[model samples]
Structure formats: C-alpha cells, structure tokens
Target: MEAETVSKKWEGKVSAGLPIPTTAAQVWPFLEDFCNLHKWLPSVDTCYQVDGISGQPGMIRYCAATITASSTSSGRDETMIKWAKEKLLTIDPIKRCLSYEVLDNNVGLKSYVATMIVLPIDGDGIHGCKIEWSFVSDPIEGWRLEDWVSFLEPSLQSMAKNIQDALLLL
Candidate 1:
C-alpha cells in the first residue's frame, strides 16, 4: 500500500493596491464572504472560510496560485489565513478610517495588520472613495516588504476594483 503524503511549505510575501469608487460599506460584504474570494481576486484558484459560523474570529481564509510580479515562480501557491473583526479596531464611518489584520497570505506574512483608510473624494458629480491599505506584517517568512506587496496587492486590489464595478451595475 502507498503511504499518504502531505507537505507544508511557507514562502515570502508581496503587496499592492488600487483605487476604487465605492464606500467601505459597499465593499465590505465582498470582503467578508470568504467563498466569494475567487470572484474578485484574480490569482486565487481556491479559498474557503475555516469557521463558517457567523461573527467568528480566527476564521481562516486561504488561497492558492498566487505568483510573482516578474511572472516568475509558476504554480506558486499563496494563502491568506484570516479573521473577521468588527469594532475591535478603529472603524469610524464619519472618519472613514479603520485598522485591522486580514491575516496571511497577505503581504507574505503569517499575519498582516492593515490600517486601511477610506477617504471620500469628490468628483464632478459624485462622491468617490479612495482606499489606502498600509500595514505591517510578520517578518518570519523570509520575504522582503517589496516581495510581500508583490504576493498580495494584485489580487486584493483587483477584487476591490471589481467590487466597485459590480456596484455600478446596481
């Protein structure tokens, strides 16, 4: 009989971001639903929330098929171990600033605490939103800050933009 085989391999990280035209509340649902991760994120081949229970912390969110900006490292898998925290951190709707961790494989760390600020920008006829995700991640993964951004930002930012686009259809 053949023996069962499993492996746990951890690599470095990358991060990036893009601007969008939706408020945080409008984008929050898409971010909260772990199953919908693939819809917005470009590189995620698979993802699921570990604790499906509502309002559960340490609810795991994992992913795969994340690669490098150079387009190197084919088949490089990435994961985001996540939890949902509400009001645990700073979330002032009037201020449009919040701070919390979205977990790994975000920014190539086992954990990433992103302090994202959502500022409302005025256009000619509408109030748009500007999002800035700046965070500090664990350095244990042997990945540089630049590398962390590379591993993370593309898909996340992609989803953010997609969410904005979807909202426009409504």
Candidate 2:
C-alpha cells in the first residue's frame, strides 16, 4: 500500500460593515473600478493597472500604501511604502458586489481573497446603505484572528468615510 500525504492551509475569515448615508446605486460606481481603490482607501497611496482590463477578471493591479510604523531609535516617526499585486476575481454590478485576490504583497499574507458589497438598508427615509468588506486568507504566521479583524476595521471605516465624502463632492 502507498502512503498518502495530506496538506492543510489554515484559513482566517473576517468582515466589517460601515453604514453609509447613501444608496447602493450611488456607491456601485466607485466600487466597480478594480484599480481605483486608492481613491477610497486612505492608506493606499496609489493604484495602477498592471495587466488586463478594468472590471475584468484576471486584471492585475499594483497598489502601494504608505504605512507609518512606531518611532525608531532616533525618535523620528518611521514610514514605509509597500505595494501589492492583486487580481480581480469577480464583479456583479447588479448586485453591487466585487471581489479580488492578492497575488503578491509586501506584507506577506498568503492566498488572500477579499470581497466588498454595498447593501441597501432602510434608514428612515434616508437613502443609505451598508458597505460590507470581508476577506479570507491564510492566517498571519504570528498573529491571531482578532488581530486581522483589528487591522481591517480601520481600513473599512476609512473607505466608508471617503466614499461618502466623495459622493458629497460630486
């Protein structure tokens, strides 16, 4: 008899929702652009199309984010710019949903897949929606599930705020 080998990939899933004071219809346009994440994510410095077409699967985007770390030995704030290559997976305009997966990233999380959806909700006659951002990825080597959740919460909050602000400017 031949011996069989099994491999396991530890996965972590987390989501965060931000209530926006706008309708899903209004939010869909911004979310539709695969390489426009930098416009809404405050942490992202820039996002450019690397390959394929916008809004299409297999479209690769290079996204760079400016991150600030704790103070260094000299007491000056430390900042670093990191980038990632991500591929668009699927998008459903009618459903106001989009998804993408990370191909390579400077931060080192593996097999990261993320989805964002805009959902309509009754806001007492106010046109409002909830932006839900979720991701499934191989757990960070030394971090727990809660740590990932903490890392994501702020980014989602910033996106929600920026989206609402952008819509107001239009």
Candidate 3:
C-alpha cells in the first residue's frame, strides 16, 4: 500500500520596508555576509556559516537569538534562547537581493522564507537607498500577520539605522 503525504499551507505574509540613508553600495557591504547578521541586527545573538560557501546558494547558516522574558506576554518569568538553521536559496549582489528559507527552528512557525532587497531612491550617496524585507510563513495557531510584523520591525528598523551610521563613518 502507498502512503499519503500532507502539506501545510501558508497562513500569513508580512512585508515591511525601511529607507536607509545610504547608497546601495554602502548597504550591500553590510548585508552581503550571511554570517554577519549579528553585527547589524540587534536581535541576533550570533550567526555562523554552517555549510557550503558564504553568499552562495545552498550555503547554510545557524542563527541564535535571545527572547527576553519581559518581551513575551505569556507571563513567563524566564528568558528563552531560540535558534534556527537556514539555507541560502538565492543571492544577487548586482541587484542587492537575497533569499533564504528556514530548514529548522525552535520557533513555532512550521514554514518560513524571507527575502531582502535594496533599491535606489532619489537622493545622493548618504541618502539614496531603501531596504525592503518580505516574509511568508505558515504560522502556528494564535499568531497573526500583525504579530509577525511587530516581531520583525524593530530589528529591521535597527538594521537600517546601523547601516546608515556605519556608512557615515566611512
């Protein structure tokens, strides 16, 4: 007898973008390294290259983050550490874009994929780029698009600021 397989459908999608006051060239350097996320994204505790090659498709990355107890509304009093293994699916430096999909994570989401793209704006060197992030996931129960947006916005907004500041010092 043959067995049947079940597939989970995506439940929600969240998209957010932030304008960075820097050129695409400047921002690309900050985002190119898959293992360097921890340096710019405040929420990431660490990111390490696991397999294949950096910036190439099939490369794997292990990322860790700490979820403070106070940040959760579940009334827990202890902090938690979350981690995930993600595989690089695509990368295009010329267009300043990259995409990755999560392979495994301690988080509740069953499926997740994200893409980041940078585009030029109408300004010069210090103010001419916008970084946009789009995420699609099959969220677990009790989660909504707004919840995902709220979870991602702070880190992305912080990353934009970090990129702008780093470029200004150059």
Candidate 4:
C-alpha cells in the first residue's frame, strides 16, 4: 500500500496598506471594536457579535453583505445576502494589532486568517497613520491571487476613507 500525501502550501496571500490623515490613536478605536465592521467597511451591510465578548480573543462576529442582483426572468431586482463568521484569534491593544480567522462563510474562502495593524506615521510634521492588512488562505474556487489583491486593496482604501471621514466629523 502507498502512503497518501498532503500538500501544506498556502494558496493565496495578500497584503495592503492605506494611509489615513489621522493618528493611530484615532484609527485604533474603530478597529478595536470587533463587531463594528459595518460602520467603516462599505461592503459590510451589517456586523454583530455572535459569540463571546466583543474585543476579546475567541469573540465571533457575523458579517453580512447584501447585494442587489438582477432577475432577468422576473424583470426585477432581487436581494442576495452573503455572510461570514469570523473569530478573534488575538488582540494586542498596546501593539495596535489584531488577528482573526474565518470560522464559517458563504463565500468560497477556506482556511482564511488575517491580521490588521495600525502604525503611526509622520509626514512633514503631519501626524498620520497607516493601516496594514494582510491575509493568507487556502485557494478559493474561481479566485486567483490577483483577485484577492484587487478586492482587498479597494476595500482597505474605502475603509480608510470612511474612518477618516468619521474622525473628521468628530
């Protein structure tokens, strides 16, 4: 009998950073609350805690994205909802970093883990911050590595813009 083999290679990995015209202190608060993703992430229609306490390791959040789909047969638009449950793996307030992994998702992502960090930056004496987001995952069906980057880059940019806009209003 021949022994079976398993491949342990990561199929997709991506990293992106967005600079916000604000301090890390301002940005960290928005990210620290695990259940508030809908506030800053444009694609998230709603996010809420499903298990455990917010901002703590082991906390799980259910995030949903609702989209309008064209129904050619009915000649109308229909609403579709996709969701993911993500669990907080680690959080370090002092370091301004957190990590999470997807527990369940309607999306095709598998073995997905992500980390987010807020770093302080100074540009010509303007106090600002940069948010670094990176992830690794098993290959998603019908998705290329470039597809992941394409999705993440714009999402992060929009998130940064939303957060900055909110902070400016405060």
* After superposition, candidate 4 runs with Cα above 4 Å error: 1-21, 71-76, 122-127
The best candidate in terms of lDDT = 4
Q: Which ten residues in a row have the lowest lDDT in candidate 4?
A: 9-18
Give residue 101's error in model 1 in angstroms. Answer: 5.3
By lDDT, the candidates rank as 4, 2, 3, 1
Residue lDDT tens for model 2, 57-141: 8899999988887886888879898899999899999888988989998887788888888777664416477777778777667
lDDT per residue, candidate 3, 1-170, as tens digits? 76755545553333323354457776877777888899988889999999998788999999999886663666667778899999999999888889889999888766788888777765454546777788777755686667777777777788888877777788
Off by over 4 Å in 3: 1-21, 70-76, 123-127
Report, for every candidate in turn, its global Cα lDDT versus the true structure.
Answer: 0.52, 0.79, 0.77, 0.83
lDDT of model 3 at position 159 = 88
- lDDT tens digits by residue: candidate 1, 1-170: 97756323333333233344455556555554545556877665666555434334344445555443432466555544333322223445545455545543433344556555544455321464555566664554565556666756675567667777788889
All-Cα superposition RMSD per candidate: 10.5, 3.6, 4.5, 3.1
Q: lDDT, candidate 3, residue 110?
A: 69
Candidate 4 lDDT, 72-146, residue by residue in tens: 999999998999999999999988899999999988878999998888765331557777888878767787777
Between candidates 2 and 3, the one scoring higher on lDDT is: 2
Model 1 local distance difference test score: 0.52
Q: Tell me the spans in candidate 2 whose CA falls farther than 4 Å from its real position.
A: 1-21, 71-76, 122-127
Work out the TM-score per prediction: 0.52, 0.83, 0.81, 0.85
Candidate 3: 10-residue stretch with minimal lDDT: 11-20
